[model samples]
Target: MEPEQQPNNSVVVVMVPLTAQSHLNKLLQFAKIISSRGVPVYYMGSTMHNRQAKDRVHGWDPSTISNIHFHDCQLQLPQVITPHHDLYFSKMFPLHLLPILIQLREPLSSLLRSLSATARRVVVVHDSLMSFAAEEASLISNVEAYYCFHCVSVFALLYLQWEAFGKPIDQGLQGGDIIPRDLPRVSFEGCFPEDFSEYAAQNIQWSMLDVGNIYNSCYAIEGRFLDLMAQHQSDKMLWAIGPTNPVAFDSSAGVHHKCLEWLDKQPQSSVVYVSFGTTTSLSDAQIATDGLDICNDEVIKQRFIWVLRDATDGLDICNDEVIKAQLPNGFEERTKRVGMIVREWAPQLQILAHSSTGGFLSHCGWNSCMESLSMGVPIAAWPMHSDQPRNTMLVTEVLKVGLVVLKSLI
Candidate 1:
């Protein structure tokens, strides 16, 4: 049945996601779920980002869902200028996205005030990194703001500990640091850049003012960490509503993705799926590792599908030039039957759900972790940066469902 054409507005939600692909994709899935439940959702972002999110969604078309409205904010920002020197890919991504917070402040506030006139309550669910953009929600009448964390509970717990109590020294944590001795010690070794401290502090301070916090996680895997987080923030409510992406794509919808067709030809439990999320890209040297070039005589025989993203823009699809430049010489021809390389943007859920998919070689991004776990696929956790190192620990140490490929950046 087709949903109603117009919103009646008992309660309205506004989703503000960071412009990164992983963040944008997960939040849109959450918006689709909310709209399906009869709540109207207004997804606000720059024109380019809004188009990217919609174009990149799989299985279903969000445009067909009338309740989910896409609002394109007009911003005259210039094209993102890439740095010539090497900065960690994860940190480099936020350098492009964080400026949007300052630009969005006034526009979001105006939208909230306008929505308040018609709706009884307006809920603003902004990305955890985007708190500064939604700060004005506190001043607007009938508007309530909540921080939506795309990472897991364990990472959040440790990140909050680090933000609250500085990096621990040889002298040990001073003052009232409430870190659990049992958990992995907080380390910024492969985490956020030093300049990001002020932004992290802003998010931490904003979290304190919000009434509730939301995570893309569930109690099944991170129940202990979630409970520990609740103890620390007794005044605020914590909700673990996750596995936000569809567990299974609707077969009845008749969507035929090409990757699934290839997987169908492989034997059960034969293929290892490889993807490193959106923002993390390997250095050229890292991409040339012997294990990746299945042509190497030393590596074990296996069938695999690798999603190699464009090095220039992690979210952009890799063109013929990128694939030709990045892959080892004749690597594609030597392993044609045993391997498949998707340049960018594979239907990850569909691939993970395939019977032939035995394991996932992933970057331990929280959304990737949740999707793999939901599909009963074990991860080979190769963490890159940000909260990924802690998320890697959650997968390998706590859940024991996966093994770590590398603990940190080489």
Candidate 2:
């Protein structure tokens, strides 16, 4: 069971995140941590994705760091497939990038080999969706590969494994289904997107077989699940190295000073900061109804900031006119004195860290959840899709730090 000898001098960590903002952010945060410790990192992605990564790094003051490199695999995707719709791209892009990644492995390895001579090793850390491709490429190039679960709890991983490999937990278990008996109770129903159950099942199977796994979580919060994972899956190495907020590493000046300035004006722990991550979009109907309810409520109206991102694949709500048309008539004018509606991107980490920020109205995405918890801000979990429901459960039911806002209320 001796470890294989690597070439000397340089250590290279290749990060291949699914072409999603959240996924990329997590991997980049991990890469920064690795690079800060003296290892060189090669962040691999499609040409467009690499460009975006470069821009993001530049925004974060890249000149301060020298070891993290953006390696474009030169994947030319079709015009029909845009980066904004990362959910679709996550499933499809790998088919196109896999062969290209496989081909680039040798050149990547050779380039790393040329760097130095004392324990030179190239480790491929990839998003869960890209694990299959990364595993094949790592095998071909004789490099180490690890699956990075950028979002989701350790319990989510365990659930996926159980669903995929273990006997079907009674189909009739309904919303009250408790899983794994030992772990904290989480609703089995609506925990995952029903449409992609099969896809998730397959990924979980492969992820279990992979060399190891990385999570954007830490033992401080999810130690029980981590411990359970270790007890059961002793053969696999699970690293809980996160709460990986980019603000910890990036010193991007003036990114959101205005937001902070406004926050400073508010009473401490009085404002409720609201955001639904990057991907989830509120339907026009939901916005007209539920959106107005929250905005117009006397209690919530006085101290709220809602970040409303455009529906990437569907509507162009980024246009002020479009946003106006979608919102309930006079909603903005009604709440203008008390609330702020951010149309596009907002500097989330800064806002969450602010003293004036009392609570979070979040989609319960793992990143959002972690950021909120890290800042000691409570939450009103309103999950829209994917692993969010499960994360909501962790926040509300297990952690006792948050409450779930039922979709019926939203």
Candidate 3:
């Protein structure tokens, strides 16, 4: 069902989830902040997460915020995004997508219908993959739309655009005017010279610039896509904020409660915060074949918390015993004096902002980076996969806020 409109409601925001907690958490926080600005915010999503985790993360008992309203809007999703790991991310393409595409029509149709009737002048804010559907909906409903959540940096997007979607500037344009020959193309450590697919080499002309991908953050072009969408809006009060997932400020006590206990036992300014974003896993192959290979050789002289989650059977496999078992010889013994906290869960905001905290070792996930920057902590950016590597580049090269180890363009 679509959200019902109130006459006093000046702004209406619709949020769609991107599979997991990290994604939903950021979106919900942004909604809460916006709603607190005296604008009415209505959140629509079904009972997500297991019972315990849901209660713990969002115990939104009305007293949490003064203005925001939580509504349970159950949106049955496409089979491709169905929550199962195998079904969700098996391959880039499929042979039997006909039936799946047929199934998708219903949800897609329903999505458009709901937005059209209720959210008449809606400003749609969306996440990464959700942008595909949200863009489709906004186009059909003729409402303002913006892509949020995580947008990789200009270098990262250029890298992906060059490797996945376009060719390097060296190759020159095969069918249209090129983007000038002087600008250097981002290096793809994983991409091969002859790796050009049929779609990769195809030309994308300038008239189609508006059809390019949208990112949440970038080294250049802040709010470009959103501004393009809102171009005709001279009199309308319509704009897109961000796909922000904010941690509960009041819950800082609970987060701090757990963090302070950990810090109380350890030395001040010694513990390192390490967390990989949701859906980005570090395989032993990803460890041996690519990223962690470079990170493994780095010298560590301080106490640390290394967040390594294995992507086996869709469960976080980096338990205490599992972590100790997989580590190379002498890693634990050598770091014994320095101390390493190995927990599947940590209060990230509390840990990052703590006075005792020194630096962050991260995958450059947008939310984590934002939290670290807002708290004035320096970052050791080790971006693992996808847009993360891109975000890392801008942080180091453009923002000069962090240190990027290597530019592994995905």
* Highest-lDDT candidate: 1
Worst-scoring 10-residue span by lDDT in model 3:
202-211
Where model 1 places Cα greater than 4 Å from the true spot, the runs are 1-9, 81-93, 145-147, 166-186, 252-255, 290-298, 311-325
Residue-wise C-alpha lDDT for candidate 3, range 268-378, written one tens digit per residue: 677766666554445444444443333332454556655554332112221233232145656556655555534355557666766667788777866677667666777
Can you write out model 1's per-residue Cα lDDT over 1-410, one digit (the tens) per residue?
11123333567888888777778888898899889998898888877778888877765788799889888887755444333323446533455556665687767877777777777778888888777645677787678555555454555555547555765522223343334455556565547765576787788777566777788878887776667667756887888888788877666673476778889899999899988777666666667773375323236667888887643343233223343226778877876778888874678888888899999998888878888999999999888777777777777877889998866642
Misplaced by over 4 Å in model 2 are 1-8, 54-60, 78-119, 145-150, 167-195, 246-254, 297-300, 313-325, 408-410
Q: Best candidate per TM-score, number?
A: 1
TM-score of each: 0.87, 0.78, 0.62
Pairwise lDDT winner, candidates 1 and 3: 1
> Per-candidate RMSD vs. true structure?
4.2, 6.5, 7.8
lDDT of 3 at 370: 64
Predicted candidate 3, C-alpha RMSD: 7.8
The sequence of per-residue lDDT tens digits that candidate 2 reaches over residues 1-410 is: 11223346555676767665667677777778888898777776655665555444313644468877776665444333323322432332123333333454444444334432344456767787655544344444335455555467775666655555554533213333334443444445554444455554555555664677788888889887777667656787778988776534243463655666778788889888888765565666666666667666554555788887643322122223333225666776877766778865577777887788999998887878888898899999887766676777678777889997755222
lDDT of 1 at 147: 56
CA lDDT, candidate 3, residue 247: 29
Runs off by more than 4 Å, candidate 3: 1-11, 20-22, 42-46, 49-63, 66-120, 135-150, 158-184, 187-259, 264-268, 284-301, 311-325, 328-337, 406-410
The Cα RMSD in angstroms, rounded to one decimal, for candidate 2 relative to the true structure is 6.5
